[model samples]
Target: MIRRILISCGIAFVTLVANAAPDDSIKVVKGQVSDYYITVTHERIVKGRVLDKNHQPLEGATVMFFASPMHSTTARDGSFAIKGADNDIHLYVYYPGKKIVNKILALDENNLDIVMEDEAHKATAVRRPAQATRWYDPQAPLSRTFCNPVNISYNFEPFNNNVRPNGSFRSSADPMAVEYKGEYFLFSTNQGGFHYSKNLVDWEFVPASFQRKPTDDDQCAPAAYVSGDTLFYTGSTYEGLAVWYSTHPKTGRFKRAIEKNVLPSWDPCLFLDDDGRLYLYYGSSNEYPLKAVELDRNDFYPVSKIHDVMMLRPEEHGWERFGMNNDDEVTLRPFTEGAYMTKHNGKYYFQYGAPGTEFKVYADGVYVSDSPLGPFTYQKHNPMSYKPGGYVQGSGHGGTFCDVKGNYWHVSTCMLSLKYKFERRIGLYPVAFDGDGVMYSSSAFGDYPNWAEPMDIKKPADRFTGWMLLSYQKPVEVSSIDSIYTAANLTDESMRTYWAARSGNPGEWAQVDLGAVKTVRAIQLNFYDHKATQHNRAMDIYHQYRVYASEDGKSWTLVVDKSDSDKDCPHDYIELSEPLRTRYLKYENVHMPTGHVAMSGFRVFGNGDGDAPQTVKGLTVKRDKKDRRSAFISWQPDTDAYGYNIYYGIAPDKMYNAITVLGQTEYDFRGLDADTEYYFTIEALNENGRSPLCKTLKY
Candidate 1:
């Protein structure tokens, strides 16, 4: 009699027929089986040595076989060995600061030697498959300080519309950051992927598309929430959306938790209460108020009826009016969106962005309540995060997240709407809640260098590195300039304008005179996309340039060199390893990703030899009786000052809101709570430092 038996091991199964045999041994399998197949197969030990182009053994190199989990790291002698089935296999070799090597080799071919080329020799070496370049070198030491416009590569707009016939400029906005398992993940609109960081300073991009459904947009104003060990994510959609969940986001592996949401939401935010209840807040419109609803944690479906949260009150909230500077209420209505929630000390804070993102006055406002979905009361100090006057403006439509050290940070959208209304960037600021329970985000010196890990959490200003701008309004000379784009635009402190070279060619340069020798600490090179035609995210595009410093106009010393860099940094900020004293700085272009070489700002930051600007003598504050939210403040301008900072709050001791005004003595203070009494102060700033704040005045 013949009998059939099936044996399963792990993922492979084998079917066998038991025919009477003298030995009674298993016969050959009919289906594919695992390595534990009854038949004996020979395994060979594959050995290899990895070396650089110079024939020097590259220690710490990683060697692995493609399509196999087996990997080994080279020892001090750059030799690695792995035992595998005797067959031809694809091998991959990787080393820091070197290009990856991939080759097909026979497992029996032992003592194999592989040569890798340095990134600097990429142009001359044979082209291989493109690999994703990390934002920072993994072998280099982690950075302690970082500058804003946050530094990661922004993605080009993916679609072509009437606004952009070709492709749109690079843009990212409506940011949301969350801390999961000691690492932070950042998500922004239209950036085909997200970025994760162990130290917020060194970020690695993870390519992922959460839009499993048929939709034109990807993750627009995505909502991210961490619960237990898993992180749930979804994007703004008018139709049913999928909620993706990932335990290991670093690997970019996410599975859909909810295939289709029961309700549709735009600009959504997910909040999980301490008691384990989940809620969602969403809205992005000028005609409607933000809405909220309780959700079932298991199924991620709404359990309670939608509740009307809050709407734009432009008549009483000056900052809510729609305009470039909150001054266009007559023609345009304000937009209320970007809903976020943070529960602290038993009170729930509902934060939302107001006005318009296309304007410099884009800011975030907050309301306090005792319940997740309730009648929330407006916070007296409105626009909790505002940076209307800075190198990069707009501090709205973002999420607040806490780091591992319990420090709170607000990552918001910074406007760069010159190319399209959606063109934008992201900025991070220190957030704190005082003893009185008033929450605020510090934007003073917002665009300057700030500490990634602050020294003190109580003092929000401690985040600033005390690096003053030394290149603002300084004299500049360029090799060639287009008639429409003047050289003066380089130091004009505006992202909307730029100085373009006659051509995007090598050796084109721009030199800036600091007027006097000053101690230089950091430099920020803001490159502009002047006539760029890229419509999609181009990973291979990069920028290469060199910066030099000079004490005298003639003798120059190399300061920052990136001639062979394969990474793209449109808004590149470099902190020198050591401080240098120089009065003149020059930026020489080696390569441009596309279009003419253009720069919005070549900002230098450090201390000046001279004293700080003097405090203002004449100060005035006039509150509008018709609309209590409006006020007019002016101070006597300091002759030696390049800018001024206006500080105001509900009380003298609670002065947290600051607005950095450049080359202006008067400001139309229009963001205030109608019933709150306020105090105001002003201080002058120059290349050296800031003056002592003027005496606090009550209004």
Candidate 2:
């Protein structure tokens, strides 16, 4: 028998208080495990705090799951606790007009700090999906950082020395970024709202203007399209085709375009052709082939039946084949989803994400159709947006939009499925058309803190962040540890192993010694809740830690002090306004939310020696004899190099594009404008910085 469980989630930033005050209005049995969930091998207590966007505690919030009978509520501190079954559960949180949260709770998981935004606090506006009321200004520098799976808090407080911990954390997928009114707005499934920004780097979350709030599945793979003056929105729903429209997304209101389902749509996209026609593309699972249908011009509803548009062929398209390098046999058919359409210079470009969203290689593959609705042909240069080797992966299921600088950017999803199966992040990458009119995504130096093209000031031809490891394999010291967990785990560069203090109390701490004075740029402190059980029910717990640096172990200078901080940061990072020179960095725990001070990454990013990398050797650039548009480039390995960069352009001085490969010595350049002579240069990069460009080669 299926049972429904009730529980709430929130990240409270309120005055410190216990959730001990019980509300007589509702009855809840705390720590009471039930058999409603199957395979109940173990039952654990779940605890967390809920807060509003303003960092205030949300009182009397309700949290529940659709599958279990257990339920919970927030007390005065906007905190809740309930017994969790062995199975994973999705908890739904509701506050006044705030966008609701559908957070996941695994059997062994607890301690959630959820944040909600209050809708009443903002100036709200109503809009239709087909009208656009705003535009972006091109006079400003675009926000440069565009790494996938980045924490939103990371963008708000950019990578700097004075940056604070992430007060809010979220996982969103199926990105749809739209440009309007001199600004860009980003929408994602389960985000409750959309985010807007003048520069792409710094984003502000605003409630979506939807006539009807989305249900669970409806939020999975939503789609958006732009017409003359309207921005149309819809989502995956077998129940019905619920469409929304908004001219001003920043104001957080959308009117219903269609309330009924004319066609069964999932993982959908609404495409409007240049000839004033419209179409819808969808089909999210591997089990089904992708299909399209034409929409009526008047109501924007499906006019006729759905047409079978395309199907997956793993044998032909290796990138579309399941698993990394297309090797998975267990799941024979790869999941073909995230259908998108972009008309570039009269050619219809059809893009879809494949392999699987959860995998590191999750990416987009493109097909070209002469007509908006037609038989499409696959592009030889498949996997339109891919980044397998980076701190973050999975650049798929995202829409492309033009920025104020007229540069095209694809905002895509990043994968971090550990916390939950669908746990994700988002990123943006630059796109350009080669001389052959071939579309290409620039990810060579992707995810790094690279400059954002001409919109951002022109830096070195290679756009690397110049950030190198300062903490990997470094010596670590902790206050005390349990048997298995050790201080060494902190710098082992593995998320699987973590350092767990014997007790999580004020004054407990850990320190990392670089062994010598090194210029430090950033510190990322990742916290892990491993079977943690040391918090009062329904109350907020925040980061009250102190960070200090010292040239020597004894003499310390305060670098980051959160002793009086009210922010909750499970995955915290800090950047100094200016680089700090120190041999030792200490992370002192003033207070912890769970039973012990558990940490996975006490990472540090900076320069060592403040020097450039060794020059690459034996640089060879040979144009593909068979394919003039393609080039084969290779270089000799530099022992101290963390990665290599390949720069190429049609003109000698205009080497506009680059590719950064880590631990690899060779890269094939496909999708180059056919019949164009190219100039090529290479460089090596380490923690310190990139070396000078190698001798240029003409192909």
Candidate 3:
């Protein structure tokens, strides 16, 4: 039956058979179809209209209909409908906001009209999801499905402030992002203070007085090298492959001269040879093979004495070991850590991050060479294509920068989930090069682009590389505010449907416009948690969140909270304090304001008065079991509805419930004991009744 339904839909069974007749004015039958067929099918009804490079019609445009048994999808107007007996087909059209269409169908036809063209949203500009804005029509006929591997969106800075890699410091690969002049430093080794970005989606934290720690405790090999005023680094200490020197290379201040095992075999890299010598590649990985020394053109150090070179592994070349057969256990068993070498134009690529490290369909690889050390050559289409969120499972220690207009970039670091503990994160991709220099990784970059590289307003100090002009950030004036602060009206959608009608919410809370400040400090609540919200608050509202600082926006102050209340909040951030100077600020709503409150955007650096915002009402709790120690609460008649609260606790207690739970979900008490501890809380009832108090959980 069509090769047993393409082997039970894992698809991929090519064998098309030929036929003549059934043709009554439509001919397109080109053979190949076996594996016991006898079903008399007669498919072929493709239609299409996925457009953007100005062609129009692209409503969810995702059509696919590869032939060889079958595979289909295409609706929302870009219609499709395959049946399959075999008449010829091969159409894969995916329009993730535009662009991605491959066709070559020849099925006797009924009415075909495909036209898809979105060349990467015309170079990056497609950020739509407020229900996708509408409009689709440029002559329709679209329908087909089964092909989606293009949802790529770039602009990364997913925080990997490492140092949390535990037990003898397990492992945390490299991240090395650099933009120098205009800002974007990122350097990684899992974490050691250093994340500054001017706009790669806002990143901050360069404290530890700008960190460069040369010892006093070392691990370092998250590599950083600056060139021009010299600032090269390497780390793996007890004092070993150490190497640190900074004539203020971008100014983080360094000076740890150990020179002796310059490559104590870690992740150091520093090439700058065009006759000036300074090659230092290191590696105890990529199956141990990457070594080089040569340095010293006046204190670049290590003048030669490292050796090793070559051995990035994998490639007996012959069906590259046939998919190497993944009976599927997610498969992964080949190694080779990060190896870096780049040379553009004179050609010498050689990137790495391969085989094992939590396999995601065999990780990254690239190779080519003219000489950085020798004999590179892989890339007959090496393992380059498997990026489930570029940061999935310990990506390899990667590095490659080039942006003075030579435009080549690649910074890797993966592990946002690889099952085996340690959630490593950090990603940035976009490296093209193929004229034999080999390097291709374009996860769709047709629009909405910005990974830094476009701020040379006539050399604004070359974007201030290694930055050092720090001055402009002072401006917080909301009409000399003394404080009348009520705040919390968030552009009202009935107060976000009244806090999304509570229960496990995702709505309500609006009072933002903090565009003038003098001293209100922190407040960032761009919250969102409704993947099935409903656990009664405080698991740190789905793991972690706390950044409350208010000067009258309604009595509050918790300032940048994160005593690790469990862990799992991440959605990017910027809640500040220690540098206040505000006009007013508000965004108090620590995790899960109820259950599923969604807010995709909200900024308030200080200053308000945009008016309207001050309602706050959502509480309804009920529980009655009086005597085990307490229980007997009643509620359910909210005038303008806002009166009823209760929260209980006990079980790995940190402190769960303490009064503040009125208008009944039932609550009464008197030391009983089978277990002993218990907790519950709630409060908010007004228009002349109950207020003040809120808590939830206990069992």
Candidate 4:
């Protein structure tokens, strides 16, 4: 049987006051009986005074009524009055210096008095999933001092600050740092070379034991595993994997034991089993498939036994993917890269990097299995993090480690300096597990249990305030409907609009000449694929169409009604119709409506005379001398019309026979061959109508 238990704040205080005079008796008014009511009641004359921690009355305290729809504010005397009805009500009292009070009460007595205290918990101390972690010392003075600068795109950036006096190479990603005997040693890999560090942070260049080998200088990512005095590291030298062993790790020199050239791999990591066998698990990228090989404790090479772990394949999961086939264009499709394994509480946590380990998809996730080699289950609430704008892009290369306190932490590289576009900085975050032992990234030091913050509701007009257009989905042509329109509202103007006209023909841009209107501030183009329209797909699923406006119709500005949108865009058309105003507004364009096409419902708003425009006639058309099949044409725009139009014909006598009207000043006709003669002419159209044809010339 499944049961849902509700936890309630059990603290309550009741206050009732009785005055001597009859006139002072509590006044109760029977308000209009309705389904909804506020916490404060009229007849009860619920008046109250609130004080702060020091017992001083707080001015401008916001007393909120939850579950109910009504609330009132404290006046100069820290007093408020409310007309409430009997209901399950929770009062949330808030002020600048006082702690927030959430009180649940059933109305009985008339008079109410309350006092609030200073909250010990500060707002800034609130832990978030993206911020929770031991590495993030919220109270630490040096919390924001460091920066992350690493490019996870190529998936290879060395860590550790181990530096040499010559300053040959940089290494701040020191994951395999251990102190043997009296000296400390660090291991790092970037691109295809190896580096080491005496200290954990500072790093120095070292001769790569596998670099000088007789190959084309291509090396795969590396992972180091140290047990007792024997140091083991995996290296990919051009072909397959080559395991290197070294006793003099401090000297950074190693000797190869066995090189297996079969499976394609990178970022090879070594793990030891209870039976004393070594397991090699590595992959191409966090998005690629990961393979595993069993190494004999005797030789550290493949003992003729191999295993492959299917952690993740981009196509299997619903997340974004990248890297394409044949061509070099990067897609949102998945390509696995970083793969690390950790054992905790009898469970093996297999982590994989995905999408963009930074900028776009700046988070990491983990899978768990009871046995180290069995099938694993992926965490549901993954993306494990929400990284806002920061230097923490591609932050998923380092491994997870346990601190001295037995707490878990994750250290990875964050691309801090994009200057190289390839190098990145290393950073650390804390990892916490739920009751089920699922690894998750934390934005704070502790796990948040059953806590959810209320989202603030915003008005439509209020939403577009101070908005700016930083970028568009793609560059657009004047014809295709899918264009992006954006705006920046600096003046805070509430209402602005533009006008449009429905072309008599469907699926056409009906020209609306804003007659004599010089400047246009705002515009709106009505897209009616509604029930009355013919288009069904657009009407059924809802897509956007194109609508543009201009200062001078001749130099028109493009506006898209709906182009860029996630499946769950917070603001949709339903919200727009609910009384919204804005200074700058653009119609985002989308594909043509599915079932219906629009030809009517043209509208115009803003400060302008909505009327017909004048037409211009004088224009010229000429065929290209090089390729007679091509034609070049120019036309004079009408001053009153704010734009012009043009047409052409293949026969000289039928100059205006075949016409293709254009908006801009020039038009280029393609697909013509050399030494061919073509005849063309021009005409101007506006709100008034199409004008007479002008000069026609042949090449």
Best by lDDT: 1
Worst 10 residues of 4 by lDDT: 445-454
User: Cα lDDT of model 4 overall?
Assistant: 0.41
Off by over 4 Å in 3: 1-173, 177-179, 187-268, 271-276, 284-290, 295-415, 418-423, 426-570, 576-699
lDDT of each candidate versus the true structure: 0.83, 0.67, 0.41, 0.41
lDDT of 1 by residue, 286-351 (tens): 999999999998888899999999999888788898888777878867999999999888999999
What lDDT, from 0 to 1, does candidate 1 have? 0.83
Residue-wise C-alpha lDDT for candidate 3, range 355-451, written one tens digit per residue: 4444332345667768776666665543442232211222345677765655655666544322123334444544655444446553221111222
What's the lDDT of the predicted structure labeled candidate 2?
A: 0.67
Q: Give candidates' CA RMSD values in order.
A: 14.8, 15.5, 23.8, 29.0
TM-score of 1: 0.79
Tens digit of per-residue lDDT, candidate 4, span 328-382: 1244445455567777777877766554433323335566777666467775444
For candidate 2, report its TM-score: 0.64
TM-score of each: 0.79, 0.64, 0.25, 0.36
Count of clashing pairs, candidate 2: 49
Error of 4 at 66 (Å): 82
